[model samples]
Target chain A: MQHSDYVELTSTRLNPHVDPALTVWGWEVPVYLFMGGLVAGLLFLYSVVVLLRREERYPTVAKTVPLLATPLLGIGLFFLFLDLEFKAHVFRFYTSFQFYSPMSWGSWILLVVFGVGGVQFLYTLAELEPFRKTAIGKWSVWGLFKKISGNTRRKLAWWTLILGIALGIYTGLLLASLTARPMWNSALVGPMFLISGLSAGTALTMLLARARAERDILVRFDLLLVFMELAVILMWVGAMAHGSEAGLEAAHQILGGAYTAVFWSLVVVAGLIVPAVLEVQSLRGKWPHTVVAPALILVGGLVLRLVMVQAGQSFGYGA
Target chain B: MTRTAHKYGMVVDTIACVGCSACTLACRSENEVPEGLSRRWVNQETRGSFPDLKMKIWSESCQHCENAPCVKNCPTGASFIDDFTGTVQVERDLCTGCKACMASCPYDARYIHPTGYVDKCTLCHHRITGGLETACETVCPTSAIVVGDLNDPGSEISQLLRKRKFEQRRTAAGTRPKFFLLV
Candidate 1:
């Protein structure tokens, strides 16, 4: 075939492998990063409970949230390995240090978070077991409770929570530093991710609070956080829309492409509006609607992550 | 001994690129790039319709910038260049495939190779050091692609670049890339 006049015929044969990548970032990477970001945010907010609230009221959660969060972050890293073509090659990150690479920094940060968080969690659980005994142990088992929550476990929990929050926010900063992707280039991304983590963490905390605290408290706090989360998301989307042309194009692709339905339905209606109304009702002592709001908000927050990860891919040049 | 320095690059005439991807294929054979991998590519733009249809092509590869971002951001020093010769090379053994270099590059030229190492065009450093031209330039049917040291005033690349107007991608990114497009 005759080559076009305006285009270059710069090689002997036509290249056969010129198609666009099919599964932009694949399922594992997007899901894993989202999970990691959420875990980071959640762990940070949980620390606030430890540092701010009275020891008697917040100790149960402050002691327990790290136990849950540390594991999720660990699992998130496992999913990250799935994105690699050669999974074992990831180990090289530790053997050789590269200060300029974000991945190298991110991996190290994750490792520290997990290591410190995991030990602290186990320590706090052991400390709690002593209190679980006596009349409390009469309901449970005295020996088992004693073994899980022993003495000397006090300071570890606070340290773990503090480190976890710092690590989580750093993860958000890593993604924001990449200027190549206009969609991710905004200064808003790091803070947005931090807020997202708070939303997810609090949603999970509220779910747990339903069992531990009064239904009234759970319903009120959960609904309020849901409203705040939704507002953050809207601000994020609006800022993206008004940014650079490339950024706007990226946002439109999110609105119209694969992420559209999830953004509008799950994040907006399910995560925010519905929850806000139900929470308002809960504040007014309307009990029945409160249950529905938190559950929907949980599901909606998850959908928000799926949409954000998948949305980044749609910005690729099809040609 | 005086150091022998070379800064390799390409001069593509955007007006002559047909989007046939011939340069891409030549690079694969010359460099033995894996089946699903490529060292060069052409971006196609289609506009208008029917009899008034028009398409433009922008051929791309590693721009080999004077201020290469990949070299700057590589964490393990896996992605580096010869300070004397200016030939950027990747040390596969050291690469962690963290995809950090991929993000730092303004042109999106770098990628995680199948071997979990970073991969991209290296300007055929081996062949050119043997006093041969780049595969893309040697095989170009229309002679649309050129490669040489921009520092060499007598080189064809330097002459053509000096004689005609040229453009580089993402000028605002301030890469000062060696590659130029005669648009």
Candidate 2:
């Protein structure tokens, strides 16, 4: 049985230290986590292509994507550490094995994804041999080239894609699991990441596609992803606006507060809108703008993540 | 050693609060809290017509909920509720400072302290272990704060609840906080 009662009490002296005003913790954490989630999504998309499909056309871009992601994750993690009072003791989370913690789960997932993605990239380069039938070395052939160039490699590529997507999406689910932060507590956060990651991944793929003159297929795919990402962003923002007070504050901080310009103008406008328009133009048989659109979309996707992470950090869930 | 399910909690009488700021000093002294930080605090509210305005004070801190959202959202398992004492304990060493708990808490009960570890009220677990009341309860000038077992029908908290009604902070959040607010 449940009962609701309002109890009354008598006079007691008060304390001054507990200010009724909100604290700083609300603004910093969510934003930081959002950035990390986006970084993971972007890298996963880039790596899956290189690792699973053997799309080894642009090796430099493939490797650079992960390198770029490494710093974002590291920096996001540092902000989190410093926000918590710069205590080294908190580092024990990395060492302790707790199945229930969302942080532990997220950290572990990131580590595995990054580790596997990195190795997969290096292995791709190793497979691309320049000696078997080189124009200058036609006289001597080595068997090392044959081992990495077959269907076996393609199957492994598929496995890597599957793994990367799973890890990439898990990052969002981990955040959403916390029901208290209603902004992040929705089931959509997982799909949000899933869709966003694909869009970001597509953005990255389009960039590479343009670089290697494989623009036709990659550009269309990137355009579709940008469209999908826009939908996800709308839903994500709507969810935040409709949730509890904490969630509202978190959303407000992003949509109308500190994160507004970056989210609306940069992430939504430059990132999604410009690219969407360019994509439409291309679909209408305008080929010149197709190249520029994917590049803009890529930048936009990165900024979108930055805004989400920063906004999450700016709000605290409190009464 | 005999183990007991303590279910320790606190009851605050808002009517008896005088807004004197003494419990703050006592808790700070007992915990050696950093100069800028406090483990317990009071929230003040002003109500009624301007000439007839009334003052209300609330002592706010961790409620040590039976179903703490902070503990669940802590990705590092750094925050936990001690089953033996019902104290929400933050393991500084294990905290990643991800601030996931801070975001997830409906009452904003947890904070990343200056020490980089999540910090909040611990229900004076150390004091209670030494056969003493929480520092806040010990120093309340008007006996406005009562700490005891809510499960025990004879305990002061339970008795107060049975005879007079009380409120818990953010009850809708489903935290089931052990701290009771008496109006």
Residue by residue across B75-114, what tens digits does model 2's lDDT show?
6667887767766788777776666676566666655566
CA displacement after TM-score superposition, residue A285 of candidate 2 (Å)? 3.5
Tens digit of per-residue lDDT, candidate 1, span A1-319: 2333233223221222112322235566656766776676556655555456544665435656666787788777787777665566677767766565556676777777777676655555545656446464345444453454343234544665666565545555665555555566566666666656666666666666534443455455556556566676677778878976666777885678666877888878877788778777666765554346667766776666566555653353221
lDDT tens per residue, model 1, B26-119: 8889988888666787776555545566765766888887766576666567778765557677888777665656655666666656666778
Please tell me which predicted candidate would have the highest DockQ against the true structure.
2
Judged by DockQ cut-offs, is candidate 1 incorrect, acceptable, medium or high? acceptable
Q: All candidates' lDDT scores? A: 0.64, 0.64
Give the per-residue lDDT of model 2 (tens digit) for A1-319: 1122222233222212123422345434544555555565556555565565445565544545544555566676666666665456555656766666656776676666556544544444444456334564443332343354343445544544565566557657766766655556667777766666566655654655545344555556666767777788788788878876766777886666777887888878887888888777766676564447766765675565555444553344543
The per-prediction tally of clashing pairs is 19, 41
